[model samples]
Target: MNGNRFGRLFQVTTYGESHGEAMGVTVSGCPAGLELSEEDIQRELDRRKPGQSMITTSRGEPDEVVINSGLQDGYTTGTPIGMVIQNKDARSGKYEPYVTAPRPSHGDFTYSAKFGTRNWGGGGRSSARETVNWVAAGAIAGKILDQHGIQVKAHVNQIGDIEAPPVSFEEMLEHTEENEVRCAHPPTAEKMRERIDQYQQEGDSIGGSIYFEARGVPRGLGAPRFDSFPARLGQAMFSIPATTSVEYGLGKEAREWTGKDRNEDWEFDAEGDPIPEGNKHGGLQGGITTGQPIYGEATWHAPTSIPKQQKTVDWETGEEKEIQVVGRHDPVLPPRAVPVVEAMLSLTILDFMLLGGRINPDRLDGTAGEYDTEYHPSSPDNE
Candidate 1:
């Protein structure tokens, strides 16, 4: 519970359980005077809400976020912004069976081992349900990013065996969210949807990958070592439930390159700014942003809440048993996980931006790093 917080300057501490009365997040370290509203947070929750498609959970969370405090006159006061979303549709009874029989590939066993108790309903804090809190905080960070001309977007590039055709950043933005799966290619999305439907019929689940891109990001946002940009991004994405792998730029493909291929050449853009010709380094070099579009990919495995019985040990009896988890869950993760990828990126980047003294709350309009000249006299970034 202590580690619930994410970020150093732009901190977010999430609270509540999957079946708890209300889930929420408290955002701290956001600069004062940014325009904010519950609607801003609600819009994000809507995208992350359950039951958007047949491929997703049918449970209607309605996930309507209510601003509890920290805003007056439609602007953030720079205090802790607290928001909550009530769980009106959760059916705790359905998860009762999972209490004694922990499901495989889930946090039930580990959580109990760590806390000496666990919320059997909906995997408690271990549930991806907790991601809603992240999306809420990310929405605020996104509002800040917007003023800075930074845009964070994600796409379901692959679902199960269906892979979207290669797409450019512009193409993904233009058409990624046009479909439920959030894929850039329409044909690939259709096939992906059909695959999810097929899995639903089989009472099973599948897994796939998502790609996140952050555009217009200011250079030098990452801290050196320890909290490196890619390291921070990796930790954030890997925290999501069922996210098994994470890679940036060429990722694993970097291993196939020779010394010549590994070396990148910098070319001047229209503004005469440096841009990497070959971004096998993924818009980052020396653990910091390199003024190029930052791209990352994460692979999530199948949901454990499947109809098929799986072998597991009973926590209470220590006896082996089969558990056919009964509950509504996504047929695949990428469709719903798209927002989460964006959320983590927004939160992590904003935190780093804050630490690097990039945010200028007073300016209301301008890119993040544009305010560096207006830094506090006592601040190190000013010298």
Candidate 2:
């Protein structure tokens, strides 16, 4: 709970539970006079909301965001931005059986052991639903980045064992939105969809990797030594539910390559600026952005709420029993995770930019027309 707050300059603290009456976030340190509306937050929420497709959960919550504070007319007031999304479709009845029988792969048992009490209803705060607040905060952070020409995009790169071919950020932006799986490769998306369908039918689930790329990121946006750019990005990425692993650039593959192959060679550009032919370092050298795209990948495990019966011990009886998971769940998590990953990237970059003195704090006037309109919400790849 202490770690719920994130960022240095532009900070956010999220509250509420997965099956509670409502979930919300309090955003502080925002500059005044930025163009913001319910639609701005809703657009991102729609993407993060469950029941969007067959591959995601069937929970019918509308996930509509209500801005209770932080704005007057159509812009931020620089105060704590409070927003809430009500839990309209939660089925607590499905969770009655799990009150004592904690589900595996979930935080139920561990949370109970740590806190001495647990909200057995729909995994409580541990559910992926907790990420809705993050998606909302990320949307605001994204708006801040957009004002400064920074763009973050993510796509499902691998589903289980099926890996999509390497694609550029622009190509991914164009093609990822074309399919439900959100992968740039049409063929791989089809295969992944088929596999997800098979798993859903068998009452099981699958996991995969997502690739995120940050474009138009300025240099010198991260601290040197401790809080490196990639290190901060990885920390935020792992904050998401089910995120098991994270890596930047060549990631673990660098272990197989010699220093010459793994290290990026810097050369002088036409303007005498440093540029690298290959991004083997993932755009960050010495824990700072190198005026190149910052790229990273995250791997998530399958959701634990599969219908397949799993063994669990009944705490009251002190005997083993099989649990048939109920309630809506995702057959695969990568597709839905694309936006979540992008949000984290946006938050991290914006935080670093603010910390690095790249973003002008005076520019936050909360008036839509006051800020410069240099960047639009169009695909970053096209730019």
Candidate 3:
């Protein structure tokens, strides 16, 4: 219903609904002759699709991607790239009872209040299914970034009170994909899965934090003043469903430190290059990349749909009623959100690269070159 598009030079406009025949995205401004295939996009979609593991929703959709347009002979055509994934396994009937009863912690109440009516089937446009298009478009973005050796990865950092031990970005990329929970630490992933299974059995849900890292981003890739890189990245990330909060670098914890503790002191290397002693700034200083690994976290709320009955008012009767949402949902959203967060990061960095003139927009397949500066992450003093 409007505001489906994102980005300036490299743009994506998503369409379709949760219970619709299918959902898709049309990506424009992608340069011609980039190697792209259905498998490229489908691999990422499979990660975001439901029924991956016991912790995820049971809805079984293949999430097969169909490249309907903009590619010729297995490469991009510099026009709009259209891709769709059918919703063969959607259980729209389960939502019939909630048409008039708004589920708590969901967009239903706000949407109905603004639109006067709604599709009332599978949460309509507000469903997490809308993120499928983002994953598809992000796959292309990943391809573009890969040419420059830039990598974006995310993992479940915390579920409830179970926080995993800190690991390097390289270790995360190596091990996070090993488990369905997407936690790099094997022990923590096991506990997270066990906790999620326990909650699902009780007809409830849980929420957690997801950590994201982008490596090899060239410095000077963000706009200064109002359109800062962190600001733009936050905007893109917050657009995802259930993303309640986002913080880069040390995030809210930075507030607890004094100037002496918070400031990331810079030193000169043997060659007189600036070396940061800490990442208290999260690789961005004054809204631009410092050529260091960018780290951030996003928090998600527990899914609103649950087998546990929730109290609500019947719109027609103006009387209270009890409702139990029966449709499938992720007991913990952070696992599914991993790919979504990475996609937003890709979109943000790619957009900033375009805005800052670091990458050529017209020549999408061209390289962004390299930053002269090198970043070495010293042990964080405050951590």
Candidate 4:
């Protein structure tokens, strides 16, 4: 319960259960006076909402975001922004049987052990449905990063051993949303789609990884050790449900690399600023930003709530049973995780930017009541 909040200067706290009436997020420390509207948040939510494709869940939640507070004249009030998305399609009846016979490889048993009880509906608080709040808060964070010319994009790069070739950041933005699988590479996306359909038909799930990148992030946004940029990013990625591993530039592949090959040589850019000749470090040196693009991958395990018959034991009766977790569930995760990854990237980078004093914490421009500037939301009357 206490761990629901994330970030420091730009904090976000989420509430509501998966089968509850609504899922909501409260974001604090967003500097006042930037253009904001439900539309801005809704656009991002639409990407993460269920029933997006054959590969995603068929749940019918619209995921429409309602901004209930923290705005004045379509601009941030510099107060906590409160937003909620109602749960319209949750069916908790199928989960009733699992109340005592916790599903295999799920949080049901662990949550019950920890809290003595749980919502037990559609996996309740343990559901990936909780990420709706993350996408909402991340939408706000995306808006903040946009004001600073920072860009974050992600794509489904690997799906069950089908990997796409490397793509540029621009390519990711351009092609990620063009397909159901959200892979920047077209052929790979099609194959991934086919692979997902196979799993869905088999009444099972597949695992995959998302490749994310942040461009135009300034240097010196992280600290050494505990507060390293990658550390925060890893924490963010791991927070997503079912995530198995996180890796940065070169990542685990660097293990087989020699020191001479792994180390990036320094070079002077056209602007006469120092930069690494190659970005194998993933834009980090000594746990701090290096004024280069930060790129990485986060892998997710196969979703646990599949329809395949699995064995479980009822805690109360001490009886073993074969149960099939039949319900609306995704065949794969990375397709829908693209936006979530980008949102977390934006949130983490914006938090670092605020913490590093690169962006003003009180306001976008560091001045109060200045609405005529570029960062200010434009008025329809003016148009």
The sequence of per-residue lDDT tens digits that candidate 4 reaches over residues 1-383 is 56888887788889999899999999988888889999999999999999977678899999999999999999998899999899998899989899999888899999999989889899988888999899999998998888788999999889998999999888988999899999999999899888888988888899999998988999888989988999999999999999999999899998999999898888999899988999998999899999999998999989888888899999899999999988888888888888888888899998888777777777865564423212211533111
- Prediction RMSDs, each to the true structure: 3.7, 6.2, 6.7, 6.0
Task: Please give the RMSD of candidate 2 to the true structure.
Answer: 6.2
* Candidate order, TM-score descending: 4, 2, 3, 1
Specify the poorest-scoring 10-residue window by lDDT in model 1: 374-383
Per-residue CA lDDT of model 1 for 20-122, tens digit only, reads 8989899977787889988898888888999998888998889989987888899888788898889888788987766777788888778888888888888
> How far in Å is the alpha carbon of 160 misplaced in model 4?
0.7
Looking at model 3, which ten-residue stretch has the lowest summed lDDT? 374-383
TM-score of 1: 0.92
Residue 247 lDDT (model 3): 97
Per-residue CA lDDT of model 3 for 132-157, tens digit only, reads 99999999999988987899999999
Which segments of candidate 1 are over 4 A away from where they belong? 271-274, 361-383
- Compared with the true structure, the alpha-carbon lDDT of candidate 4 equals 0.88
Relative to the unseen true structure, what is the Cα RMSD of model 3? 6.7
Instruction: Give the CA lDDT, 0 to 100, for residue 278 in model 4.
Output: 92
Q: Candidates' lDDT values, in order? A: 0.84, 0.84, 0.84, 0.88
TM-score for each predicted model, relative to the true structure: 0.92, 0.93, 0.93, 0.95
What is residue 207's positional error in candidate 3, in angstroms? 0.6
Model 2: per-residue Cα lDDT over 163-218, one tens digit each: 99898888887998899999998999999899889888988998999988989998
- lDDT score at residue 324, model 3, on the 0-100 scale: 82
Q: Which predicted model would earn the best TM-score?
A: 4
